[model samples]
Target: MLYVFLSICCSVIVSILLKLARRYSIDISQAITWNYSMAILLTWLFFKPQFQNLQAAPIGIYTAVGLLLPLVFWIMASSVRVAGIVRTDVAQRLSLFIPLLASFLVFGEALTPLKIAGIIVGFAAILCSIPWQKKTANRKVISNAWMYLVVVFFGFGAIDILFKKVAAFREIPYTTSLFFIYSLAFIIALTGLLIRVFNRKARIVWPHIMFGLILGVANFGNILFYLRAHKALASNPSAVFSAMNIGVITVGTLVGVFVFNERLSLVNKIGIGLAIVAIILITLSQH
Candidate 1:
């Protein structure tokens, strides 16, 4: 339970850090690039996952995911910046539908009646939650932000599938696989950073580097505490899964609305209500 709480707090903190970054007009790509280096160091120092027992098959999956991590992360930061944390967080959590859909398609899992209903309602909720600004307002800004949320939803779901694959691969420990993933991610992000520098689109900013260090700590802490929660609640992993999602949604929504004054329409609020119901139905369907 302690671990669960810590994980939830850490997850919310990462979002908060991103919010702060945007508030300060910091270049998120640079921060995210530096984030990988910090994450790798923390993974090595604490997790100490063995790299000797590496397997080629799992490495391929991790490398592929590593490539997507930074790209999706940048999109997520953009989502939070434009769409606000509440909508972004809800879309991210509801991404479970993708893996559920993939399971039905790939593994021939039974799509129970409730699961089908949940998928339908879950998607409706996502559509509703998007901030559809009036034409009188900034239409392009609103539309672009909403699209970012859509990308984040599917992007995270794909990453979740890779995580499932990593978990299933018993030949290599997941921690070691994560180390490799982080290493790959670091290389990828560094390359992106260098490209930006060469193109003169961005400059080496000291403040951005400092912000990245903070983001890196929070980002890695979120993962570290989440893994710890699973270890502590191995008997009932669903508890961690449910609590983590709900907690983040609840906390993120509050922080977005209260702290940042992010506005949401009545329909958007209803979408959040339905999203919770849909999440429970899907989780229950698994059993």
Candidate 2:
């Protein structure tokens, strides 16, 4: 339970730091690039993942996750900027449904009554959380705002599926696979940063490095604590899963509304409520 609480705090802190990035003139690309460096360091130091027989690893999944990680991360940052933390957090937390969708449609898993109900309610939650008709310069800009939210929804969902694939690959230890993925992600992010710098679109600065390191710490802590929570509750996996998804949305909502004064529509509030109910149903279905 303590691990769950710490993981929730770390997750929300990452969102808060990203929210503050543009305001503080931080270069997000550079910061994200450096973030992987810190993650790699932590992985090496704490996990001590050994790189034995890389040939046996699922290189295809590793490369795909490496490509998608930084890309989806950037999209998430954009979503937070456009959609606010509340909606973005809800969409992310609710991404667990993606794997379930895959299981039913692709893997031929049994779809019980509770799973069906959870999916139905989860769909409604997504529709309500989205800003369908908001005032902007034009309809396109309005669409663009909610578009980030939608992409964040599906993008994170797809990433979740890919991560499950990676986790299932028992050829290598999960920690070793994670280290490889993080290393590839760093290489990809650094390539983009260097290109931007060469094109005079960005520069290497100390502030971005500092912020990136801090962001890395929060990001790594989220994974570390969540894994710890799972290990601590190995007999009751449902508790950790439910607590993590629900906790992030709950804490993020409080911080988003109170600290940042983010506004939410009446429908959006209802959607958040439904999202929580949907998660509860889904967790119960597992039991």
lDDT of 1 by residue, 1-287 (tens): 78878877877877887778877989999999888889999989998988565545466788889998999999988888888889999998898889889999998988789899889989988998888774235333455678889999999999989888888988877888888898899899999889989999999888999888888888888888888899899988878887888888888899999998888999889988888888877767767
User: Which candidate number has the best TM-score?
Assistant: 2
All models: lDDT? 0.86, 0.90
Model 2, runs deviating above 4 Å: 135-143
Candidate number achieving the greatest lDDT relative to the actual structure: 2
Quote the positional error of residue 45 for candidate 2 in Å. Answer: 1.0
Pairs in clash, predicted candidate 1:
none
